[model samples]
Structure formats: structure tokens, C-alpha cells
Target: MAKIAGLAVGMSLALGAVATPAGAQTIADLQAQINALLAQLAALQGGSTTTTTACSFTRSLTMGASGADVTCLQQYLQGTGHFTFSGGATGYFGSITKSAVAAWQAANGVSPAVGYFGPVSQARYSAIAGTTGGTTTGGTTTGGITTPGVEGTITVTKNPSPASGVKLYEGDSMKTVLGIKLEAKTSDIKVERIRLDLDETGDTASQDSAFYNKAVQKIYIMDGSTVLASSDLNSSTVVEESNEISITLAGMSFIVPKNTIKVLTVAMDAKSSWDSTYNADSWTVGLATDGVRGVDGAGVNQYGPSAAGVFTNSFTTEDDILDSATLAISLNSSTPNTQQVICELGTDNDECDNLEVAKFDFKAEKDNITVTDFVLDIVRAGDTVATATTAYIYDGSTLVGSASVAGTTLALMTATFSDIDWVVPSNTTRTLSVRFDIDDAALAADTFVASTDADDTTAENSVGNTVTATG
Candidate 1:
């Protein structure tokens, strides 16, 4: 059809140009105008609209313009609750209509409206022009559609601070107080209540709110550090409906302000399907619920369609701290005491004789645990030293390792009976020092086979890693 129309215009111009040999130059001028008009018509046609819906305009409609397009714009704004036209549909783009258009543009992500209907407004209008209760839908007595008035937007977020969610590993999860958040903005609707339904599904080993063996999941509503209220899925108010183990949280109040937002917190977790294996396909937890709020002027509440939010756990399974893990050992940097041996001189042998003892330092493998005590085996020694005589652990300048000392076998290495109160955090290494007069004069190399932590749910034996002494 467009090609036919262009061909018709060209033929008409060609005939006119040939007839007027005297004004032959006028042919170029007419062609230019025709081409410009065709380009504009093409733009309007391409705005994702194919209907004869007379909701778009070619020129900008300002305060003085008057046409059917202006009337359509006025009606559209009124439908979106941005305009309140008093009299019958007048085709004039007057002050009242201009003000309404500016407000509509501002609300629809087009800020700082100039009160002029231009291309930007045209694009947005064409998008929502086909709503079920669009301009075509008629209402009794009120003279308009009531169902598709204004929409309320509600959203739940995982990391409200960063706006980007926290990295969750296999065992990693987020909760109301920790990361998950919720926010809602009411448009023309009078929001009397907000209902939130959270569910976990898929064969991904993810557990639902019911997995806790309790009624539902929990959430905390906070205003900064102060907790306003706490709600859960099992609440008598939130309707429980989703089949895949779900929880619901609904807030009821006298009145929720228009264009205002309210935010809260929720719970989200990585799928249980995740193990040591790196899972690039992490499961998603969904926040699903209808825009169940009060209708603007209607006496009843709970209207409109539902809105859903989903958060993808992008963290890989490799990041998971395994149920059982490895604890390793290393040699820390320390100064060597170079005193030569004078073993036979002293009678009060409170410590090793004049033999020069090398002060050796040791460390544990990286973990997210505070290791209070460990059983070490000096599998290999640089000088084949009998055992570690004096062991001390330090957190900066403060000594924190538990005390342990035994003179019996190679299995036990501490003298003076002391254990370092040490901790091995996740993905990070921690250091403790074992400085003693070995039965042998050589630096003692050692192996850590395992460790013990009563509080750690994720515990594994030590890697029994061998730390070879250089000296």
C-alpha cells in the first residue's frame, strides 16, 4: 500500500512537471514536499500500531491547537487518571488539556513535560492505547471504562543498597533483615492492602517456605535501624495459594498514599540442588501476587491483575562452602635465633640446652570457622625434631590460640600446656606460631591431618598438608 501511494504521488508530479515546460523547476520542489510528508507518515505507521485507532497526531498539539487528535489525547489522559475533563470532549488544546498532558508525560518516564503533545507522548500513547477498557469501552452513568483505570506498581528486591543483588553461593541465602527488600507505588488506585506470595520450585533442590517445617517464611518491616513490624507467610491474613510450598505476606492499612512508596524485607535462598559442582543454571525465587489493593472510588477492595518479581541467583555452585571441607597448614615468617650450641654447660635445664632453636611459625587452611583447637602430626621434620615444645597463637598483638601442652608422643606437639584460640574464616588464611626447643636442633617440619570445631556445621578433616622447612 505504501509503495502504491508513493507511485501515485510520483505519477501526478511527473504529469504536472511535463505539462508545465515553462515552470519545470517547480517539479523538484513538489517532489521534496511529497517525500517529507511520506517520511512522517511512515514514522507514525511504524509505532507498533496497525489499527485505525485515531490516537496519534502528525504535528505537535500545544495550547492553541484544536483537532480530533487533541480530543483523543485529552480522553487518553483522563483514562490514565492524569486528566479530569469537566465538559463534553472539546477538541481544543487549552490550558486544562495541556496541564494534563504534561503530568501524563512526567508520570510515564518522560520527565519535565512542556505541556505540548509531541512524538514522545505519541509513542507511549500508542503502546497502551489498546487496553481492554480502552477509549472504546463505555461505562453506564459515569460515561467511561472503570476496570482499566490506573495501575499500582509493586516490586521486591534482593539487595536494596547496591540495587544489584548479593552473590549467593550453593548454601548462601538472603533474608528480610539481611538482603531482600520490597517496594510499592500506587497510581490512581487507593491501596488498602498489599499481598505478597513467595514460592520456590523446580527440581533444583530448592526448599519452599514449608521446607522449614513451619507454617511459612518470615519478613521484617524496618525504617532504618528501627523495626516497625514483623510478618510471615503463615499469617492468617496473607492468602496461601501457590502449590510449590509457598508463603504470603499482606499489609492492611486504613489508607496508602498515592504516588508514595513503601519498602520492606523478605527472604531468598540459593537452590538446595547446588553442591560442590558449579551450577551456572542457578534457580530463581519468585515473588508473585496480584495488585490486590482497593479501587480508587469503589467501596470494595482487591482489584486489578497480579504483578510478579523474580531474582536470579547468578552465583555458581563452586562458591558453596561444602558440608565437609579441607583444613590446611603453612609455615609463617619468623626470625631465627642463631645462638650456637653450648648444651653441656647448664644444670637447671628448664628448656633446651645451648643448642640454637629455630623459632618456627605455622598457619591453618582457609575457612569460615573459628578453630579453637587442632590435633597435628609432625609427619616430617627438617632436623627430625622430636616435637614442638612451646606453641603460641596471636590475633594481631592479642594471643587468642587455646592452650595445649603434652610431653608424650609425636601426635602431641605443645609444651607448657597451651592451645591457640584461633579462627579460620572462609576463603581466607589464618596464622598461628609454634616456637619451641625441639628435642632435635633442626627446624621441625609438620603435617596437619585434621581439626575440630564444635560450632561449625560444615566441618572436614585437615588436608594433612606437609609444610617442608627450608632451613
Candidate 2:
């Protein structure tokens, strides 16, 4: 059809050129226009002239992959004289397509020439197809249907701070594990699907099944805090072939306009409880180079970079620390304790009893916690540790426990009051007052500092699970 129209236009131009007056318009300029039109027509008819064909190849094609992209590859190869098969552009990559690809690769100086149309071959073809005249050293014009609108290109950059070496404890929900940035170059891009490549290390077949069944609760594609799409990783949404997992986002509507960047985050929710003994394993998440499926403003499918080793994020599963309930400890804000105290001189070096030093408040979440031990550290300024002889822990007016501050060193001493066995009910706070007994040998400005830190106190929940305090 294009050739017929070109022929009619050329005939009219020829007749008009002959009938024109000599001085009205230059005969040379008319002939030049006619010649240029003839050249373009010949290029369109797949002649010796080379012309750029508007076709975009977003995916690497090999044997067995069938799509419009493959058909485009075949048509371009046929025009380049590399594909000589009788059955032309069947839209399926068969043995003939392989042969044609190998020939094209060899002609274009692509190494090895094994007929695998990968990133290197795609890049080389793109370079040739993007040239002004669409002509290369050994190839003629590319023949294919001209795709309408601008040629869209998507660049996928791996996130700089991908979550790595993370411990995904039980009950961890909606944790972002992998991310990539997508930039649309020439047109708006509508991202419809994303493919995740799963790599499990030290995982058995049953463990893999367990992971898909219950370990991973849901996988989500997030834009900041908004969810674009989510899947439960069941058979309906996921297809597993070899080491790759393809997730289908059929109804997703994530769009990246031209000259803009959109961040795509992959997050997953872990089940609150899983069989740690059976399903614990390290897993790495990545995007398959051709897995990011989307369409540009022109409604052409776009893919992420086909380069290998671009994205990688690894995480391991571990047993949860808080099994029954959470135990939190913090410095009591309501306590009237002061760090610096002025000791009154009573002739014989000031002796102070029950000097308030530190106060701790412990809370149990959802379960009763019996605090079994409290570890205290006392530092005496400008005096020996013996100046602070004893440290007592009082629950209001009742002395729960006391320890002698004579262990460890002279200036700094550690006092462990064990077997206190103070029970704090669920959702209740337990405040313990820490007091020090200062001997009369201390100077006027001397001070006894008492403090405690997280993980220094131990407690057991109602279900008999031992837990360390956390703020």
C-alpha cells in the first residue's frame, strides 16, 4: 500500500515538473525533491536504501518466546537480509528466528554469535535502529510496522539503600525489602506488572512451600505509604518456573510520566508465627531484568533493564524475641530523684541513709511479667565504692530487694538483687525506687550515682517465656 501511494505521488511530481515554466521555480529544486521522494519510496519498499523503522524491542527474544516484539525482530531481520526463511515474521521465535538472530549478531560484530538476543544484542540493534539513516556497515534498512507516537524508553535503577542483611522476625509486617527507581524517558509509562526473582539459600522444598503458604503473608507494591497492588503469592497471582517467580498485577495503575521518576517499593508481611525449626531460611529478592512489565504512553510494552546483577536484597528469618508479651522499661519520669545532692555536714562527715538515686518503671504488655532480678551499677565520685555500702530497691514502702555494693571495683560497683519475684499485671506499670546508703566517710561534694540499663533486668512472662527489658 505504501509503495502504490509513493508511485502515484512520483508520477504527479514528474508531470508537474515537466509542465512548469522555466523561470517560475527552479527545475533543479523540483528534480531534487522528486529524487528525494523516490529514494524514500525505494527505502520503504525494502530496496538497497536504508531508512529508520519505528519499532521498539523491550525484551530479549530467544527460542519459544512468542510476542509482537519477536515479530518485529523477524521483520527487521528480513529487511536486513539476515533472515532468508520463506515463512516470514510469524511472531514466534523458532529455529528460523534463531538462525536469523545468529546471522545478525555475527554481522553486527556481537561476540560468539550464539543467536541469543540478550541485552548486548538488543543494545546493538537499538544503536543501529536509532541512527539517522538507519544504516549500518553490514545491514540495510529495518522493515517493521512503524510504532505510533514517541519511542519510549524506561531506565530501571536499583535502589541505593536496598534492605540487606536484615532479620525478618516473626510478626514483622509490611517490611520493605527491595526497591527500584523507574524513569520514563520519552513518554508516559503505565506500570502494570512486576516480576520478582526469588532465591532461597539453605531452604528445602517443604520450606519453600511453607514460605509461599504461610511465612509470607502478603506481597505489596507500594508508593511511599500508598499501596498500588498486593498479592498473597498464591497460585492465582504467582507463576513459578525454575528460579523465577512472576507476579501478575493485572489491575494496577501506576504511571510514570515523561521525564519523571517513580519509585517502586516491594514489601512483604510475615506471619505472626511460623514454625521456625522448619521454615527458617535466608532469601534474596531481585527483579528479573525483563520482569518489570509496563506500557508507555504509546501503549507499547516496556521492560526494565535487561542487564544482569542489577538488583539484589537479602534477608533472613529468625525466631521472635518477644513470644508471649513485650516488656518495656524506662526511667520513671514522676520520681522526685535528683542526681546531685547537698549532704549536710553533722560534725562527723555527713552520713546519709536512703538517698534517692534512680527510679525504674517497668510495664508488661498483654501478659503478667514477674521481674526476677534487678542489676544496679553505683559509681562513687572522689571516693571508694565502700562509701556507698548498700543499694535497696523499694516498691513504694515495701523493700523488695537489697544488695551490697562491694563487688567489681573500688569506684564503680555492680549490685545484683536476685529473687525479688515482683509480679506486674498486664498493661500495668511497676515503679521501683532505688536508694543508696552513704557512709559518713564521704566528702562534702562526693556523690553516689545509681543507674540501670535495658537488658540488665530480666523478667518472665505469665507463659514462662524469659524476656529482656527493652525501652
Name the candidate that leads on lDDT.
Answer: 2
Question: Candidate 1 lDDT, tens digit per residue, 1-471?
Answer: 876587488558756866888875576556545444433343333322112234767887887999898777766555545556568458898866765665555444443353557777676665444332222101211112132323455343445542323344444444332333434344323333334434333344444443232212344334343343345434353444444433333333322334544443434344444333333323233334453344432223444334434342222233443433445454444533434442323343323522223222333233344443444333222343434344444444565543334535555333332233344655565554433333333333432222222222122323322222111
Local distance difference test, candidate 2: 0.68
Q: 37-153 in candidate 2: lDDT tens per residue?
A: 443443334422123354677777888999988877877776665555676678899866765676566555565454679999888776555432222111222222222123477
TM-score, cand. 2 vs. native: 0.49
- Measured on C-alpha atoms, candidate 1 has an lDDT of 0.42
- Candidate 2: residue 442 lDDT (0-100): 39
